[model samples]
Target: MHPKTSSALRKVDAISKLLIHTQRLLDGPYRSKLSVSTDLESSLSSCKDQLDYLLRKLEVDFTQQPNGKGRRRDKLLRPFKISSHDLKWPFTKTEAEDIIRRLITAQELINRALQVDQINVVLSVEQKANLEKLPVANGAIFNSFEDEGEPECLPGTRTDLLRDLNTWIADPKETRIFWLCGMAGTGKSTISKALARKLS
Candidate 1:
């Protein structure tokens, strides 16, 4: 075969493989193993085009930015301002179902992390907000735990704990207890003191 013909044949093969993979991506697993599909991959673009068609049919938007932030930032894709409006919504039902999936994923991740015990982690502002948004039942009573005695709180740490505690209280979840666990000398006692002052 001619050299040029060989190269062209290779491109065709690549495109053919891409089409088959992309069809699978659209059918069941939207969670792409690949980071991002390039525009040159016509199959990927075609799948997205199908997403756009379904979005238009429903009129909810496939890539509408929930907060007018250009595009709803995908979990893995950060610092990308690419508009989802042109990208596609995939399905309306998937949006809600994906939220539940993400929540379960995160909860499992947290539990798995806690199993290690030595690894301490902090939730990002957005993660914390989403966790707080988890629904609660009606008539759920919130009982604030109180420790009787002089608080052992230190300096301005009281201020920080007060802020966090106030937020926990403001939340409407059916939280029976706030497990403020930490190692010794990690200021758990200090925070307990601060909570006492705020409660008092």
Candidate 2:
């Protein structure tokens, strides 16, 4: 609870996370054979432990710096965090790490987005020469909260919803958040699985 001790812990946590993600980036694509010497998974496991420890430490009380006449942007800025608990499907630790990295990047992207009046993603080889060159939301996918709409009969037959998934794939721009309602006759999980497979 001491300020100095808490601050030191905070600093340590920040550096550890930075190192972990940097390592992940250096490791390159998932399951790349380039990973040698140190095992990829063991390293990840250690990093996860470090992160968990930090989170537990964070649960104790701490104080942020008092707002002063700092940079104007500092006053405007707000912290960003994704609610992992809200996911319909729970992710493995590895998946969670990737999601955390993405959420961090997305927070930065939104900051950049605010400054730039207009931003449209255009995929080009030349553009991907560097990290900054990469398009924001290049491969991002998300589901939305389904709103009130006319009940269109659940896609396809009773066996599987793979039939109507073709339509979902055709539209790349939209993020469909499906809310499955109704009785046993309505194929909720089936439709979700088919949509997931199609996306995959």
**Local accuracy of candidate 1 as per-residue lDDT tens digits, 37-68:** 32224534543454344335444333434474
Off by over 4 Å in 1: 1-151
Model 2, 1-200: lDDT tens digits are: 33544554555566465555545644666323223312334544555565665456444423233454222323334233322222222334475456456444533443343233122223333345665664665322234234223233354554434544565556767466434577885756445545554466
**What are the lDDT figures for the candidates, one per model?**
0.47, 0.45
Note the residue pairs that clash in candidate 2. Answer: 144-177
lDDT of 2: 0.45
**Which candidate leads the pack in lDDT?**
1
lDDT for position 116 in model 2: 36
Superposed Cα deviation of residue 46, candidate 2 (Å): 2.4
Against the true structure, what is every candidate's RMSD? 22.2, 23.0
For candidate 1, report its TM-score. 0.23
Superposed by TM-score, candidate 2 places the C-alpha of residue 45 at a distance from the truth, in angstroms, of 1.3
